[model samples]
Target: MSTARVWAPRPATVAVQIDGVRHPMTPGEGGWWEGPDLPPGARYGFLLDDDPTPRPDPRGRRLPDGVHGLSQAALPRLAPLDWPGRELRDGVIYELHVGTFTPEGTLDAAVARLGHLVDLGIDFVELLPVNAFNGTHNWGYDGVAWFAVHEAYGGPDAYAGFVAACHARGLGVIQDVVYNHLGPSGNYLPLYGPYLRDQAANTWGQEVELSHAEVRRYILDNARMWFEEYGVDGLRLDAVHALRDTSDEHILRTLSRETDDLSRRLERPLTLIAESDLNDPVMFRPRHEGGHGLTAQWSDDYHHAAHVALTGETAGYYADFEPLTALGRVATRGFFHAGTWSTFRERTHGVPLDDDVEAWRLVTCLQNHDQIGNRAAGDRLSASLSPRRQAIGAVLAVLTPSTPMLFMGEEWGASTPWQFFTSHPEPDLGRATAEGRFAEFEKMGWNRDVVPDPQDPATFQRSKLAWDELAHEPHRRLLAQYRDLIALRSREPDLRSPRLGDLSAEIDEHERHVTFVRGRIRIRLNLGDATWRPEGEEEALFATSDDVSGNPLMLPPDSALVSRTIE
Candidate 1:
């Protein structure tokens, strides 16, 4: 037997409909309603205030049908996992979208590929948002039911199995979650209470009403559910800067404090990584230091600088990152824009990371969902660069002084594009999304004509990774290079060191070569048209090219090498 509880503040009446049988719910304290006990797996929904149509539970654990359909009773709890656990520091992350990672695009199907990640030396597998969204396929961001797993991805049971499988293979899972705004469709929270702010809004529709006590609890509880119930190691908080809250204590601070308490109780390291555009170091600072105290935060500066240095595409936000020194600055310093001028926002942006802060606290990537998907044609860096250049990009990404994350197929340079795709069932909403995507790309200097119609089913299908590419020529070679670098990182204690003070780089602007030192190791990237032959006796540990062998090393243009000085 289970008790039904829902928070609907201003509703004159509230009722619970279990298995099509209506039962009047008694109004309780804190604007909550309680209903009679019911058996598990019962189909249920809430009916409020003279409205004949029932709304899905705001805290539903399962939605077998769809986001708009009746919610199923919580699935039976799985046996506790025997996870040995992994921590965030000095770890590598691989980010993937559930719908496109595999052909089946289900959690069960995704499990079949865990061995590949384990083999590739991935420490954490970061999945894009998987909460219940409208229709069959989406980017997973247009989720309305935050509590329920998307039924298309094999529901809650499959989610549990996927997490268990990862732990079994010694991998940690980081789930991306959105709390700033609900999707355009299937959002019934407004009918129940002030879930969204009335006037204020972010880039995505209305801002969540964090001012309300219950609403704050709702967001906090959802975050904890991933760690406590789902057994995830971490949560990649999506767009935390957009979470506008003017309360005495911000929800992020409260979440940090609560998560710390929960982490102690669970006896495992539970990480909170924020994807923030603010470039604020406060997100990862300890609460005692008057900061949010999150485990880490994504830094886009490295991605932008690396992209500009490699591709020479300085359009839009890449304008300020044009100089090769930008890459060097990010290599040594945590952020390239720390208290610097921004050509994109037309204002000084980002605070410098504190001296005491560890470099590993900033998670950076060369290619990610947003960087690749947001492109006009959803083209990847591999679409333009040669195999050698791709290797250089990998070297810069993996060997950087911070925690590094690789996008879905980035290791082998998967040719498939990760375009923005959605399946909003409402015709009007679909049309609006497609149009808005085109406009946004056009404003960012992208070719408007190349932007795919996000509503088209073909768009979703085209974005899927072609796993067969792994067995082929250049793909196999690049994959090996990535594996070698990861292995080297794991073997070298200096590579895993978190001190930013140990970092220094020599940038040859004309030669287009940059060498960064960490302990006794020297990593050099030759980005020019001519090869570099430095006069030195060094033990060559790893090089992108095979020709860079023996005492006098030859660094090929558009390739990188790692070596230690002969003492």
Candidate 2:
């Protein structure tokens, strides 16, 4: 028997369409409606009193047709996950969008590529959002049905298979989930209740109401479903700053605590990684330290500093990262805006980073989904920077104490652009999206005419990874360099130490060189045209240029070298 239920307090009467038959539902005490049980494998939709329109379930687990279609009872329960007890910090992370990770563009196809990641030395695989959206192709961020697995990605079963496949290959899975807002099209939350606060305005569609009890439960339940039902190892919370609430206990802390309790129950590490723009260390600080106790968060300061030093782009977010001293600041301290003046915001931006926070709690990446995908054409750093500079970026991101993330195809220096693409069927939404894409790039000085139409099939086709390029020339060399660096990171002790306070940096502004001293290793990079030499008897572990070897280390232009002190 299949039971159909829904929460609809605003409607005078509610009925559920089960197997094409509309059955009346009785209103219960908790603002819920209970209908008669239907046969198993039944597909259903809700009818709110004389209203003729069919509505999808608010807590629907599976959307087989599309977001607009009837919600169905998902088949056979997922088998228990055979976790290998691998933690998120055990090794490095690889972030990929399932749609573009393979030519097939499905979750199972992504599973077929796990062996490649395992060979590339990835311990965790972070997937972009897989929630059901109103399209055939998307980066998956603009999802409407929070509980549904995208039908294009093979729905709920395929996601489970993807997770199991990762675990089978000794990989932990982390999913990106947007708790801040839902996508504009096919949004059903507002139909049931006051899901959005009328007073609150967010650029990313309607903001969810935190004051409502059931709405909070809706999100928290979604969080639990990923771990409990789908067997995802961790969650990467998307754009947490947009979640507005004034409750005594913050939602983030509450989620962290709930995740911890679930972790204990599951006997595995279930964690939360926040994509916070706040730049506050309190996101990952200990609860005893008056923090929210989230496991970790992404830090963009490192990327900003590295981008300025490597690409020399002084536009957009790269404006404040002048003099290249900003890189020096982030290497020693976790944040360049650590209680300092920001030329971008025209005032102080970040709170003072506490002394004791572990550097690894902050995840740093040279290329991430947003960093590349949100660009006018998703051109990677490898597209513009020299091969030598690409190697340098790799060394800094991975060798640093902080946890590092590798975007898909980053290992072989992929040449494909990960441009934003969508297949919204509606003419109005499609037009609006294309216009918005063009308008967004105008501020960055991008050519609006050249901006690919997101609704175009060619746009999605162009973003697929080019696996054939990995065997030739510079791509092969870059792949080798990445493999060696990952091996070295495991072989070295100081580089893996998470204590942020112990690391220090010395920058030579005139010569354009920065030497970082952490643990027993010293990482020196020469960004100038003149060759720079190391002062002492240090052993070279990795060098981007051939000249940065031998007794007197004469580093070449755009070179990065890591050396250990001869004690």
Candidate 3:
């Protein structure tokens, strides 16, 4: 027996409905109601005053019968874990979506492939959100239930086992958590109290009440439960820019401090990674310096710059990005658009980098969930470019001084199109979503009829990785390149940490050639229309072209090579 409580200020009387019986709940302070001693795992709901309709718990831990159904306190049988207590700094993060990672599309199914990631040399596996959303399949940015894990992904215990499996094999687990906004359907917070503000929704049609103490506590507690109770090593706070808070202390700053304190108290390495569009250096800056001291934040400027260079795509946000110029500045300064004019935004954006900042505190990637999954066709980098060009991008990403992330199946170039897909229960929502997806890509010159419907199950099935591709020629060769490059990053002292000050770049804008130098090593590339010999004197460590063996390096178009001074 346990006390059941809920914050329901709108109703005069609140009662707990358990096992087909109604139990009265006494009113409490601050718009909260409580009932004495209730069964934990029983399917329970709240009966408010005159309204006969049952409502699910706002802070529910489990949802056995989907989002619009009754809630239960889930008891997970967790396997013992042997965590290495590895820090975020000593990790190579691999971002994976559980539903599309394997053919089974469950957490337990994903665990069977953990050995593959371990063999590929990734220490951290950052999963997409597993929070209970409206659909069976989603990108997870539209999660509504903060505590409950997705029922289709083997529920809460399966998630715990997945984490244990990762820990047993020396891999740290970091998860994406959406705190900014909840999905439209199955959202019950507004019914209980003023969870959402009076203002319009930011992007996801939900305005979170971040300024309210109770609302803020709800999010903060969720963070604690994932890291402290669930044994999660870190959390990737989804879209910090959308969390509108006008309080004296920002929620991000507070969250960072809490995680930092927890890391020390537990005597284990815990990290709080944030996803911010602000491009501010203050994200990971120390609190004493008047900034949020988060573990790290992702910067899309690097992606914007690199993507345009490789794919030659100048649509939408890539309009303002000058690939060669941006890469040159981002290499040394950490942010190319830091307080600069943008044609895409139509206004100046980003904060200038401070000299004391470390490059490793910012995450950058050539291919990620967003870059690959959000596209109109959802084509991976492997499908868009030549194998040699893909290897060149990998060289730039792994060789950089920042924390590099790999999208799953990117190494061996899996032949699956990761199109946007959803399984909305509501007929109106399903139609709207399908229409909206085509309209978005239609404006970009893609045929509306050709765009795959997001509501279709086939779109999701097509996104799964083809594991059998590992045995093929180029696929096997590409895997070798990735393995070697990852090993290079691990072995080389110059590739890791705090090397921002020592980093420099040289670019030939006319020739479409750029070279990035970190300490004694340099990564040179030729993005030109013609072949050209690389300048300067250094021993070639790794080259994309097989013909690039001797000095006076004549690399073909879309080729890159890493070089270093002789030891």
Candidate 4:
């Protein structure tokens, strides 16, 4: 018999409603209530004591209707994943939002574009959140139903197909999941039990009740669902620092251990990458060594330093990273702010990464969703910088020791802005979101007038990548440069070497020039107006501009060249 169970101890009595029929549930141990089992395709909800309203299952796998509507039981599980799993090694990741990656904004439509990613030589296709939320369209951070795939994105089957499609194309899929906090709307967990801490709140909203055993299990189960059912290669844990746990054994440690166990049983690499603001190397350290044992973590310091060096915009958190030396330090040491004073936070921040740690454990990017979408105008570097300057950023991103990631359309230098957009059905929530967006950038001296209203449909449309732009002049040229750089990265052994100690950078602040030495290969970039010649006897492997040729080597302004020693 299929047993329908829910952990809702707060209600003295509970009932399971199926297709308009209410069946009484018997209370069980561990604050659980059980009733008759639900068959496939059954639309069900849990009815608490005295309240006529029915609440969707906290672990519901399907939500055909919106978040507020009844939960529909999912179809029978699909056949076992037929292919051998892949690993995250010296490879590139391409991050894209499913809603804006294509015009159709569905998983099937995204499948059609897998060939482009394969052509670009990306190893993993990292997707933004696809979970169910209240509205029609969003950035996917406002996801309320963690278990259900957003219906607008073609639901569970579509999600499964997308992962399988990526695998068929020799690409691993990394699904970004948020476990720190729930969204602002359609959250009904509190009505069933103490699923959320009352007084505790993070920047997003009420924090998950990590201290509660059942609540912790709820999260672990959700993670397992993605691995076992959806067959994703890895998970990108969003804002993991926000998950505050005072327990002796942290949830992350528990997750790491369990995931490792599953990895062994499945005989495949199950990667867990965290996006943490903590800048702590412990996240990727081995658990036996008193660390969390994640596969990798996003190194925002690299992005900040690279952005500042390329753009010379030192507003907000970019203040400390204004110097070109910042880029050199980050490229060599893996973290620029390791135990350094932060003028923005008004305090010293970050512990230095151990020299033994591999550089590939830290993912570096020139542009990503947060760095672009958080801006007041949602402008990309392509929107402002010359194509040659943008090419230097690409050289830094791909040729560095660390694992690299590229945002959608960044390779082609698409001019479309990836603005902050949402479709909150509640009018008050929509207004609050728009006002909050303005307030966030105001401190950075950004013009609030140019910031598009997040509630506007036009904002979301504006963010879609114009695939046609790939055929144009600067766009086509930039795309070719990216392809060559990525191909060169894969072809060269030294580029994939992860030893942080072996990496070195030379920066001339006055000349606006930087040279990165990876083993015997040297990458020279000229960000200044005047052409600069660096003494070197090497063969040019690739150059962003034809002007990068000479006896010694003359790199044009805002141009870059990759060369190797003749030895």
The sequence of per-residue lDDT tens digits that candidate 4 reaches over residues 256-356 is 99999988877778999999988899899899999999999999999999999889899889999999999999999999888999998898999898777
* Segments of candidate 1 deviating more than 4 angstroms: 75-81, 444-447
- In candidate 3, what are the lDDT values of residues 363-423, reduced to their tens digit? 8888898888788889888887888888888887676678888889988877798878999
The lowest-lDDT stretch of 10 consecutive residues in candidate 1 is: 75-84
RMSD of each predicted structure: 1.2, 1.5, 1.9, 1.3
- Those runs of model 3 whose alpha carbons end farther than 4 Å from true positions after fitting are 75-84, 535-537, 550-554
The clash count of every prediction, one per candidate, is: 0, 0, 0, 0
Q: Tell me the tens digit of each residue's lDDT in model 1 across 373-443.
A: 88888899999999989999889889889999999999998999989898888899889898999888778
Comparing 1 and 3 on TM-score, the stronger one: 1
After TM-score superposition, the amount by which residue 231's alpha carbon in candidate 1 deviates from its true location, in angstroms, is 0.5
Candidate 1 at 288: error in angstroms?
0.6
